[model samples]
Target chain A: MRIFDPHIHMTSRTTDDYEAMHAAGVRAVVEPSFWLGQPRTSPQSFTDYFDALLGWEPFRAAQYGIAHHCTLALNPKEANDPRCTPVLAELPRYLLKDQVVAVGEIGYDSMTPAEDAALEAQLQLAADHGLPALVHTPHRDKLQGLRRTVQMVRACALDPERVLLDHLNETTVREAKDSGAWLGFSVYPDTKMDEARMVEVLRAYGPEKVLVNSAADWGRSDPLKTAKVGEAMLRSGFGEDDVDLVLWRNPVAFYAQSGRLRLDTPAAGATFEGNSILRGTPGAPDVPAPVGS
Target chain B: MTTVPARHDTPADTGAPGLPPGLDGPARAWLADALTEAARAAQAEADPGGTWQIRFAEAGRRCGPGHADAARVELLAAARPGVADLTALYRQGTAAERRAVLLALGRLEPAAAEGLALVEDALRTNDTSLVAAALGPYAAAHLPAHAWRHGVLKCLFTGVPVAAVAGLSARARGDGELGRMLRAYAAERTAAGRPVPHDLTRVLALTEEP
Candidate 1:
């Protein structure tokens, strides 16, 4: 199965995660810029994070034969932070870059007034840039957050079709489906949906515009949850095409709206002795001296 | 693993020159309609607007991804988009769309160095598909010797087969600077305990003729 994890945070993942993902049929990923576990002090920090997603992370993924792209945003939780609010202003410039597939993780965290302003402003950015959005609904008040999210999406200038309301569960799935937006479910180890539950969601709602992701990060989340969801779907009477739609094509179709998704693996024959991290620093003598047999 | 349909193994599938012939009947029919729409769009005005660009973007889904490149080349020819249109499409278009524009540059009957910026932009990218497309006949026919030499080296670094580079023999033959660059690259790879790309040696041999 060729997998495209529509919303995995590869920035916080290790190199081994990338290798295991590739082995499990993950060929491409979109790492949306979100708040780290701790608060960031300034907008410059966000720019550095965006640059790595655009440059360094993609280079790292290329060594393992995975295509990496990212979505840029002042994430929902950070929108409330005064120090990080400047990232909203910085987002337009980053959105212009080729690797940015969407203006994302941009909905309600606590549904505060500040979060409202940030979400509305970023929705406008996505519209102006002709990109899609990956919205992270509030986890505390599940049904209320999904309601407010759907309402805001309808009221905003951006089309709901361009929005992906992620981290959904059984309580909010029906409303999200009725909202004319793409469906996104993040399978995790403890919270959020698991593989069997994800398969059940697939069973109830046919996998039309649904995108399944691991949403893995620095937390105790599993990056292989997406691959597990694919296996579960197969075991539960879903055909191969249904699995492909949910796992691969749906994400490609959604992010392809940005017209920037490069699915082609750049490092075809460029592996350096199976080590993804070692690019061989030039003129560094302390690094292993070349030994001739 | 999900079984993707294996691409047709006909002779035309292997080479760009014979690509259009490799497409099956449904894809051919789809291309015909798209071309007709593109021609009408070109005749309408210099800027045919979003509808035309959307059609250009849909070539991949309309035809298979394997055949989309050729389908786009045909659309470009039929539309006869000028430099402005090509630039907008390339800038706003996906990697796939940008690649199609680069491939069509040589056949576009361009003015002197007309689409050179597009080729240079594609060369700057690490995407191997875009790099290979940028070094097509357009680059060979027009790109300055300095940038062209760097492009050859870019292929070796990115693992794009040097064979994808159009007019490589004529461009690389008797070029001493390219030979020097290739030698430096090979030495760096060797020092790093990495296998130097075999295509680098093949290109170096071409540069040795002078």
Candidate 2:
């Protein structure tokens, strides 16, 4: 029951959740950068966010013994905001970092002109950096959003196979698959497809060019929806292999196209180096005096 | 009272009885006094406006690489008392330090639950890093409420760094019961749109036994 959750946000979760996911057999995860609950006010915020994604988040995962990877993107919802331009300018530095697997969660929300420009700019960045693009389709007008995504990918001369169209419903999944783009289904608690529907999608799609994720974040969603999808597949008489392909293999294969996604394993009995990232002082210690001092 | 054996059981090598090998009597006395004073200062400065910066800087200066023997001396003393004085050496310590202290206390005697509770209450600070670091390690062994786990999940997924998640995971991994509780917590948390920490992802990667 090994799984690779292609789209998850570790920043919103606790260590217990990590332990739980490990218990459920989630082997690897790809965290695609998206909007925080509120729009980030400055480039520094974005930088901090990126640093955490690549730095602290992975270290945290290692404590739980999971392999973690990430994608970098300027989310579509925030692209239209005037303050986003400076943040956008700063994204290139992050794209060049080794842990950035894709320029992602970066498609259309409202299909505004500014969003269009921002998406195109990011798509170009992805192409220039030789990274994959994780496209976030609109919740509303999804069909039109999917069409625009395909049109933009083609216009940008981006490799279709290197793009992942996320949050796809049944209406847009076919179009995304037809366009040679990787299809990602976000199994939500209520709004998006549920576990049963995700299993049906897998049954219909047969696991090629498809990946299932929770797209879990601060909003209303489930982090273990991917596992539930696996559960659903098993209940449907699908072999463990089929469940593995849909939940783990497919996402890993799709995101691996970026060349930056590396599945890490925790080292046993590893100690921190004096100059290592973890070797910083957070607080002071309490020591007792010698008996006669 | 349940007596959990010492987490680390390696025997200490006492160089010489009266004069610890590397340190002179005055140096040893100085080291011991400095450490005791630092500990008292840290406790006094536990409040937000406390002289934590000064205390921490002094502690760091005292804990140079050259003080390897000093570190060993502290560890030996802590082992006898069953408290993690080494972790406390880091200045301006967070709830994490407090937890380590409490766990050490718990190992010494079961009545340490009061100390654990105080540390747990301190976790409600506005500082996300401090809260995460403090609660992350103990969550596995303690298995606090789903909301606590939810907060941790949020930190890890929304943009929290992998390193923090790894730290929390390692701490949680120490207790199997806590580990199982965390798995269930992860399912619920992820269901609500939070990302599972990487440690859970590793657990998921395991091949189920036939």
Candidate 3:
């Protein structure tokens, strides 16, 4: 099972998490830029975050043979933050880079007016840059958020097929399915859908354009949820091909829209910007000077 | 683990010495069937991954110059539709999609003309990915030796790792001509104080008869 976790917050994860993920069949991941639990005071913070996504994180994932790609956005919650809004202007350059697969994790956090403007603006960015979108339905009023999200998305110039309304569950799957957009369910430890529930969605929906993710961020989320979903699907009478379709191919199909996806390439290298994920420091003296001792 | 079909152990499946013979074989047949299916519903879009493309993806065919590699050939069959409608897709698709088409062409003629044409066009591009893709498994089997060697240099010039050139071993080994070209290119880069590409060393080593 060569898994591609279409959505996992590896930025909030560790090197060990990457190793565990690789051991568990996760071959690639997309770490969408989103709200970091606390509100960021400025866009400079986002600039640094985005840089790490393109650089350090990729290098880190490469150490374990996982390909790392990211989806960039101001994020729904942050769109309301005037301090972080400057990121919207700075997105074009980053969006054009090869690793950025989509304009994402962008949609209603609170379903605020500011979010609406940001979402509309970013949707245009996706259209301009020719990338898909990974949208977040509002958790508080998800049904309403999903409704407003589908409406605004249909109204936008972006193609509905290229849009993914993420964090979906039973309440919103029907509308998302009817919207001609892609479906995404984030399985988590507590709040979001779990593996059994995810399997139910796959059984009901038939897994056409559905994409399952772990959405494992800094929150108390399980990174192995995607693999678990695959297992659950198999246990529930789904075929191996069907499991492969929902977990592996679906994400590849979604992000391959960027035309820059090269999943076959193995990423392996250690140093970056004079820093090393390796053990030894260059030109450093040996720990034990036997002669002196 | 999911039950992936074991690779066909036939001579062509290895691609051990060169790309599989495109001349009337299972490789050719699989490609034709895929093309016919792809034309009808394979997402031959400018982009590689789309809903229609999922069929090809389900066939487990990735968007590359189609390789005869095991995993690639498995999805050659699926719950797919037709392929006769591919002319426009072949003519108008993006380099990525076009590369996919060329890959699926194998060695079948007439249709081979279009695939080879796209391969030639890709070779002419400055786009490193496209140029690298131009030398994929399909190109490895079909591109003439001269154009193939130049393609190797292009990989060096463009900083595309030579490994991306599918048949590096079989193509590079014992090719004295390629060895000379690589040496001259490396010397020129050294003289200009431009660091020679790291891959030049690997391919230069591959030029060894052993």
Candidate 4:
């Protein structure tokens, strides 16, 4: 019942979420640095956030027995901000770090020229770093975004096998499969695919290099979605081996291309980056201690 | 529906260099690489920033927890750097690297004062990893009893598992100051309706037994 969710944003999540995910059999997670709910003004903000992801977040996840890895990138949304473009230059040093398994959440938020440049540059960075690429297809006009994304990836020097086109749907899964790239889907509450629909995708597509994620982040999502999908596959009569392929093995194979997907470390201590999730409450009125003082 | 079979390689555990005995070859190779990388980073510059430490951790992640612990030791063995040099790495490192530096300080020659200052700095942070790391063997051997006892309570206050304190039982066995702090801390937690750390009671009992 071990699970490895290939895409999740743990920075936006609490330590409670890590405990729940680990309890639900999520042994590992890859938290690609994506857009926060609010826009970041400068590259320095992204730098601090990346430091936490590579440094603090892994420590956090390890506290709950989950292995945390990350993908480094100037997300498509921020790529459009002229002020944030400096992030692309800042990304090289981050890409050199071992925990960064891919260059990702890159592709298009609005299909702007800026996004195109960022995506192209990152694809090269991925090649340079010898890591994989996780491309986030545009939420709007997804069908068109998926097609354009696959085409742009094809033009890059990286092999198609190294590209993971994520946030895909029924409309684009077939084309993504045909593109000779790894296919990904983020099951969500109201948008994208759901548990039952994901089962359908599995039945029709047969789980060849397809990775499913929760995309759980600063939004309405569930950290346990990958496990839920595994349960759905079981209920729908998929064998344990088939379920393992999508839920665990597929992601391991993809990230291992970077030679960096070591998923065995149990969450080590109870604290993250040496910080524990617990805090003492400042008493309402000074009761002057519980009298054992 | 068309299908193309993809091969998923189950990541295997390799032993780190200078790890405890009975580990496999791959693990030794893995740890060896980690130690080498960490040493390289520590020597790369007066400051390599977080890059080398990050790389060391990447290698550390590839192995088991036991060997991972050893990798930190091996890093110092491989680096052979002075305490001043190691302290600089700690200051410039991210939490992961600092933890490694903290782990290696006990083995470093001269037991540098700079190393203890780094430990004190880590204790000041809300970061549980630093606090837990700061309480390792080096701190137990070097940090004053008063500061060391406070380090124990810092673990309790932060909910950092008391198990991470490198030498807990021997250290807290008969320390009166720590006992007092634990009682006060527990009382405060209770008055606030907090769960009071589960280990505080065990540690409290340990102190009272003698």
What DockQ results do all the predictions give, each relative to the true complex?
0.01, 0.01, 0.01, 0.01
Q: Write the per-residue lDDT of candidate 4 for residues B97-147, one digit (tens) a residue.
A: 677778777777436467776777677565787789888888878887756
Candidate 3: list runs displaced more than 4 Å.
Answer: A279-293, B1-210
lDDT of 3 at A173: 88
Q: By summed lDDT, which 10 consecutive residues of candidate 4 chain B come out lowest?
A: B1-10
Is candidate 3 or 4 superior in lDDT? 4
Q: Give me the TM-scores for chain A across all models, comma-separated.
A: 0.92, 0.90, 0.94, 0.93
Per-residue lDDT over B38-149 for candidate 1, one digit per residue giving the tens place of the 0 to 100 score: 8887787655365656768988876679888988888888788888788878877789998999999988856645598678767756678999999999899998887787
Angstrom error of the Cα, residue B72, model 1: value is: 69
User: Per-residue lDDT for A207 in model 2?
Assistant: 77
Q: Which numbered prediction scores highest in lDDT against the true structure? A: 1
TM-score of each: 0.55, 0.55, 0.56, 0.56
Clashes of 2: 77
Candidate of highest DockQ:
2
Candidate order by decreasing lDDT: 1, 4, 3, 2
Q: Which candidate order results from sorting by TM-score in descending order?
A: 3, 4, 1, 2
Alpha-carbon deviation at A133 in model 3, angstroms: 0.7
Higher-ranked by lDDT: 1 or 4: 1
Residue A33 lDDT in candidate 3: 90
lDDT of 2 at A166: 89
Q: How well is each residue in A1-293 modelled by candidate 2, as lDDT tens digits?
A: 88788889989987667777776777788888888864454677878998889877876666556778888877776675555567878888888988788898898865667789989999999999988888888764456668988999889868888888888876667778888988888988866678777777777777787888988887787788888988888899899888887887778877787786667664522333322323354312111121122
